[model samples]
Target: MGVTAVLGECARIFTHPRMIFKLAQRELNVDISTDAYIDENRNIEQTIRADERFYLELLVIQAADEEPSTHKIEMYFITYCRKLSHNREASTGPDWRDDRQWIPGINMDNGYFQMHEYQAPAWAQHLNHIPSHIVKLTTLNTPIHRWSLPGVPDRFQVFIKRDDLSGAELSGSKVRILQFLFAEALRQNARHVVTGGCLQSNHCRSVALTCRQFGLTPHIVVARVSKKEELEAKGNALLYRLAGSHLYLSPTCSYESFSQRLRSLAGYISDKYREPCYCIPLGGSSPPGMFAFITLFQELIEQGLFDNFDDIVVSIATGCTAAGIAVGNYLTGSKLRIHAVSIALSKEELTKRIDLMLSDIGLSLGTNDIMDIIDGYIGQGYETITNVSANTGILLDPYYTGKGTQGLLEELKKNPTTFQGKKILFIHTGGKFGLFNGEMDQVMNLPGNHANYINEWPEKDIPLVQ
Candidate 1:
């Protein structure tokens, strides 16, 4: 039966003076006072219609009720309840179900809401808040480790946020960003995902792995750093291959060219698959992706690490992650200093990009006092820094985190007064797999020992018992 028919039948069957009695109908089963019934009814209807899967399951239960078999009816009812519970938990988080936070209400300023109370509307261009969603693909809450690294200023304490362990193959800041991007793709019923990055781009690999995990086909257009490097599948490229991603190589490495290529590739994929194609910008630095770090700030608040840091340092390329962090700080009214160490973009460029990103979320750098862009770390250009460093004893990718750490150390040495009495938290955005690529030759230059090296081995293999 149609939803209206079902609801009307419920109203007729419940026949009571008070509207609260109508809520006891089997389809709803909500217990609320008469005063709350109007608001509750609107919320209940919204919640029920939010997910089509839930509505379909309810219809299935309704259909099974007419069947003669009681066991079959119970099975359908149980299935519907399980789905309801799972969706509820995913939407409202751990134990905030009674609050009906998943039900979107009209915000006074924006006329939109989110699944979580902490999240604003995803696309709301308002002056109040940013956004987050519940399409979790990997486990988050990477532990923060305190560091006592050499050469750091005496009065400054350092902590590293281990985002490297965010997932197995999907580890890094990209995964957090992908959670929202892929969620939007799924909402659009997209069957193909089109994205681009460098040959060993960690972002591309993370997207490929996430797409495979979500039963979607990934098409990656990898911009070539070198002809030789393009020929080899190493680091993130290896993961792309293993994840069954359709790989394409582009000669241009510039973001503008890369975006144009992505658009063409997306069109091709849509035509080929006879399905919709979702294109994620380079580094997944879209507005939705920016929310990843905004939500991350929320996570840090929960961990009690929010107020403890005087400065938060991150290696920024496209600058979306840093922008999100800045927005979070601005929204929360915190005076946390956000250090965006440039990996590729210049100080002026980074500032402009970050300013634009902030403006996208109804925030501006002029009004927001959280942004601090530290450049001069783009040593030997963007593609030249292939030799990864381990100053923090954590596996920081050569592209982002390594350069960022180097910059942080140098900044500490040069300007001791700035970080003298402050606490610094460096974000370790993981790119461990990038070390396995052709860049290993450059990294192994000073090393006599390797991970595969053995101290001693038997002269002959032992025979099998069988």
Candidate 2:
């Protein structure tokens, strides 16, 4: 299904006063104008038709910066769909769809929108009740800032959407994931939150800050730094310690071994503490985490950030951040092409991971189906820096934002056609402290004073004496 069809359907079903007025004035019937709704429906149906093994389930609605009132409408929409369906699978089932239903609504004195599911869907089923709490995040309309490397394309203006400045300590992309994580933690009655990541993980730092804010203890399991030379006391590591996070370090191990260790640690923490402990995977790369980006995209649209650009570029690390941003763009009916610069995984592997994450959340998005443009710009392996990366890191961090920008610049150079006359916005998923130690020395190659060159001065004092 095409995006336009889905948008048209959204306009019809959402049925705002303005939308209703437009429809009335245009004399367009809802039945005729509802083709937009079928775009996603057709896409889903086509997949189901093509694959007999796959079954259709509930419609997954990823909530973005939707207000409490607006969210209620979303909840009602899902609930109605469930109540109207005959098959249990057809109804809104467990996962994010169900999770969003219980999200509490904020009280508006004006009574703008109510949290009432007036007419339930036919597929509604009374199952185990789930308690939910709404998380509040401050979304801002900050002006876009653009930076670029020398000799880059004139049309390709690299702009950073500063989610890093969302708050002082709890800033960056991690805050979005923490909102849902903390809410879930409270819902499960967890006293401590456990998560895994690298030594200088932004997600870990943000999680720690969130735990502090909500009066919950945060325990972080950090992977051992393979390169001793890269270890430093600044950036995310410093923030994590400052936030009073319980740190657990794992020795050198393979990827599977690392996972096993993290699992064992989580189990131990849960058993020893005798209190519910929530474990958040590395990068907070879950459906809930993806919702943060969805909300971010919504906020971006509300702030009119997409007005000047036809393309959006983001750096892909665990693929979760990029996935979230991609999904958000999809949901908002934005046709803007999304370019993801993979920092670690190949395009195929990254797509698989993203698709699995989406499916786990009961939302289906094919990696190939997603509008992501991947380019070969990851100079070295994950967390490994190159000369170009180092140069970029001299001005930006290598961990998240800097590497991402560097990749974006490289991709822009390679794909001149798309970037030639189009404005590109790069989402800087903050990791600045990763570039602190001796980065300048490596990038600039500065020489010691009075050591490299002899002073070019004449012996004027001797001539005056003669």
Candidate 3:
């Protein structure tokens, strides 16, 4: 902490790549500085971190000439040094580039010089504090990872928000929505929950599970397009049975029809029980449900993700979360542009949904707000997309994430001049269980030569249940 030591460290760090790489490689785990990135077209570049204790101190050196260096070594030494200083039983970390070895215990790889593996120091405060109105549901705050895929343009960077890891049994983006809806139900002094969706609806499954968790009984009215699907308890239906929920499968086509059918059903439930009930609209896209996604955007800001992203992309089925985030940026006074990649709806339809949700929350998003809908990703229907995950270790379901990602790539290609220097942040809405509903024919029919591909789909990730 002395002036002399600080002066010596500064003189040592802001130097040439040979020195930085040599020093980093020599000790590797003890140095505070690493990754000497030099811009090819510019001389002035800086990496800024808001919270000093939580982030590795980044200082970029400006050169008089334009020269790109390939030797930008990663500095995980600061992380190791902090561990040793705190007397936390420190040891040398293994190579971060090894995909096989994980960052110790978190069941995920520590990417980019083990930067991903490091945790916030003890001095760092938790970003998300539960609100007075909301009770504890599943654990909040999922990890975000930098995702690099083959065939993607090198200039664009992609990151995924891991909403799938939000819970064990009810792991999906639906959990966040349930957290807010359940809290609102409690505030309204409701006794039971009434919600409706398709047979394989993640939203209904989450509602049923969360209702039981908080001592409220759940009544689910499930609707399918056909009589055959109505009779079957498949995918999300299995979870409903396991949760012991009261389910009624009604034959219907659209959310409008389902909502119409659910209204009479919800009325009957209240009359039968002689108690108040909270009724959630289809896909939990109401005003209260969108609160979780606003919290999601708030989480991104706390973690300093908003500064680096030029475009934020998310898949939309019901368009609730996408609408929440788009309007959330406006609520947070952020000018960040949101691209709602449509899996089912058209750009006009998605825009209407966004407009409707914004109205539900009583916020008016002008026509020129930071919201754009990029359509044409839905191949056949909501149940199918063209992109396959043949050992990519990431699964993007056709209903949402896959379609959004495909649209993002296409958008970049169509408007190359605009997105040439842009960075993308892809919000992954989880549908891992839905992957088991159909065959992996679209994923397995790989025609190109790609590396680091797992080749075969791991059936073990989602075990079959009788």
Q: Which is the leading candidate under TM-score?
A: 1
lDDT of 1 by residue, 1-466 (tens): 4333333333322212133234234445543344422332232222222453454445444643553243443344345434544553212112111122212232232211122223442333364334324355566788997876656778788888889888788888788888678757755667679998887889989888777655567888878644545456678888888887878867866667779889888998888767678999888887887778877888877777656787888888888888887777777876677788888888777776677777776664552357778888876221223222333345666677767878888888887665524788888888878767765465454443232243455546766567
Candidate 3 lDDT over residue span 247-363, tens digit each: 776765666777887777778877987766789888888765566677778788877766777678888888788876775676666657777777777777767767766655556
Q: Scored by CA lDDT, what does every candidate get?
A: 0.64, 0.57, 0.58
Per-residue lDDT of 173 in model 2: 71
Clashing pairs in 1: none
Model 3, residue pairs in steric clash: 35-73, 391-454
Q: Which candidate is the best by lDDT?
A: 1
lDDT of 2 by residue, 52-164 (tens): 11111122121112222434445555564344332322112222112232344533322211111211111211111111333554344444676544446776566667766
TM-score of each candidate structure, all chains considered together: 0.70, 0.62, 0.63
- The lowest-lDDT stretch of 10 consecutive residues in candidate 2 is 43-52
**Which runs of model 3 end up more than 4 angstroms from their true locations?**
1-132, 225-230, 380-388, 417-421, 439-466
Name the better of 1 and 3 by TM-score.
Answer: 1
lDDT accuracy of residue 295 in candidate 1: 76
Which 10-residue window of candidate 1 scores lowest in summed lDDT? 89-98
Of candidates 3 and 2, the better by lDDT: 3
